[model samples]
Target: MKASYSEFVELGGQRYHVRRWGNPQAPTLFMLHGWMDISATFQFVVDALAREWNIIAPDWPGFGLSAWSPGGYSLLQYTTDLDRLLDHYSPHAAVPIVAHSMGANISNIYISARPQRVSHFVNIEGYAPVPEFFEGSLGQVVGRWLDHIAKPGQGRPYADYARLCERLQQSNKRLPPERAKFLASQLGVMGDDGLVHIAADPLTRFFAPISLHREQLIELWRGMSLPVLCIRGGRSFISKAFEHRQEDLQERIAALPQGREALLEDGTHNLHHEHPEQVAQLIEALLEQ
Candidate 1:
């Protein structure tokens, strides 16, 4: 694994943990992990990169080592955090971003709102529109949110890191034993009860009260003129989301002025973890382009 360090900074009054790797003089790349993931999730990808790069990935508030928000997480809060993070790290120049899943969704919204702050985007399996079934009326959504919050969920605990590593492997069969071990160490924190719990806050499991405005989101995507490389894992459930709606998926890709798609036939949703070398290659290719 490449050498890395952690830095703590305050954003929106919350203490955020940022994981940084490579040389400070190298070209910078801001990495964003998916939901329930941490900054260290990008370690494999960082290790596979052929060239030098300064990689900055943060554990979003309420995840990993970052401070939890008593008010819960929201898309607006994430975008605001990204805005503040950009100001702190790259105040004068736009930088490339490589994001996965929820992180990619957040980047899509942020780049659309502040296009000048992002030079390029590498979106990995995160552009799928919200399924129709997930949509609900305002009152219904709020009621569900209220019900969920009334009895907040908690992350399950494991007896030890070995047990946690086994669970990780079960989730991703392609994950190597060594990699799984490393991830278990970073993703599971020891609790006062002497059990290992997921580093993310349990509040993250609750549903948000707001409904997604798909057309409005598409319009936001349309406004982004920067180069975007949308990657998908052929064997992933995310790809299954568009199995019968390829045209709708293509339409979303078409929304971007400079968007294009790439498929890794044997990869899964966690493509960065499963195929880090290929993922790094694709990112570097886009950067060089």
Candidate 2:
């Protein structure tokens, strides 16, 4: 594995953990992990890159080693965090970004609002949840959010790191033992209670009260002028969710002025982890283009 280091910086009045890899003098690449994921999740992809890059990945607040937000998390807060992060790291120039899942969604919104801050975007399986998932009245949505917050739940604890590693492999069969071991070490932390808990804040598991406005998001996508390469894993659950709505997915991509899509047949939602080399190749190709 290539060497990497960690840095903590203040963003939105909270300490954020940032991971760096490769040469600092090389062209910079910003990587954003998905929901409940940490900056270290990009290790494999970083290792697979054919050329040197100054990679910057941050663990979003409430996940990994970053300070957790007292009031839980919101999309607006995340975008604000990203805005501050970019200002602190690359204030003078727009930089290329590779973001997965939630990170990609955030980047989509961020780029739309501030197109000058991003030169290119490689979106990995980051689409709004299908409409069916949001079928309900506004009050019902807020009620569900209220119910969750009223009875705050805790994450399941593991007996040890070995058990956590087993759980990780069970969730994703394609995850090899060695890589799973590494992820278990990074994603799980031993608690004082003599059990291991996921490094993320437990409140993140709750549903947000705000309803997803698909049309609004599409409008945002439409406004983006930078190049975007959307990569989807053929076997990912997200693909299954949109199987009947493939056209809707295509239409969303079409909304972008310069957007294209690619499908990786054997990959899953965590395709970057399962096939880092292929993911890296796609990213490098986009950069070359």
Candidate 3:
């Protein structure tokens, strides 16, 4: 039987757009997506898995259908908000979590900090500077300015829905063409200023780059004490500056507690969207472990 999409409780006054599957009363599986990505990215994969496990996927607070937090949002904000989300929706019952990119980072911290609360952990392309960037005041100010400058050009504003979809497809080449266009429709609103984007407040791009204190988070990952499955999109843009140094990411992964790594053969950084069936297959294996 197919499940339906619905909105659940709002967080910090922001509405959380969520989609569910299977029996709400059944054992659950939680899916969290990457930055600028909506829960719909998991639609195909979750649809295939939902019959047996209740599945819940929500847009991150500042992105997707969820209302953006006032004055933009940050990593810490997402972490705190997600804690509330899990608490209200699945409190007292540990559920398996599958997350990609930013979702992976936050899930690692949350599950690690409170190990018993999570039944399993699946991190897809979630490696942050495994050792983390330095965090003195200089790093903060410099990082902030560099973040904005890195984009170089003001991002294009979609003149229409079709244009928006094209831009999205360009952002992540891994998405199936038709599906990419479909998702683009939900990501913006028609406005006099062109298709004023609806997802991720414009200023959100300025949020501080997180510098995880490795010693702290490594200890946290250890506490989570659960089997972790790490999947990397074979074509992940892990090395933005030097494509040749893609393997450099390993030093960081080696720093991870310990686990076998899997590669999604036909994927980019957003591997889940590119190869949902493979991601689902990998998760099934992790669940069994």
Give TM-scores for every candidate, taking all chains together and pairing residue i with residue i.
0.95, 0.96, 0.83
Name the candidate, 1 or 3, with the larger TM-score value: 1
- Report the lDDT of model 1 for residue 213: 69
The candidates, ranked best first by TM-score, are: 2, 1, 3
Task: Put down candidate 3 lDDT per residue, 105-210, tens digits, no spaces.
Answer: 8887777666777888888988764432334576666676576645533345777788777877888766778777667776676666655565665555565565
Give the per-residue Cα lDDT of candidate 1 at 251.
Answer: 82
After best superposition, candidate 1 residue 288: deviation in angstroms? 0.8
lDDT of 1 at 258: 87
Can you write out model 1's per-residue Cα lDDT over 1-289, one digit (the tens) per residue?
A: 8999999999668799999999988999999998888999899999989999989999888899999887877777799999999899999999999999888988888998899999999999886455554557778777877876777777689999999999999999999999999999999999999999999888887637563466876798789899999999999887777788788777888888988999999999999889999999999999997
Clashing residue pairs, backbone N/CA/C < 3 A, model 2: none
lDDT value, residue 92 of candidate 2: 97
lDDT of 2 by residue, 1-289 (tens): 9899999998667899999999999998999999878999899999999999999999998899999876777666788999999999999999999999889878877887888999889999888755566558878877877776676677899999999999999999999999999999999999999999999887777647573477977898888888889999999988888889878888888998888988999999998889999999999988875
Candidate 3, residue 138: lDDT: 60
Residue 61 CA displacement from its true place in model 3, Å: 1.6
Model 1 lDDT-worst window of ten: 127-136
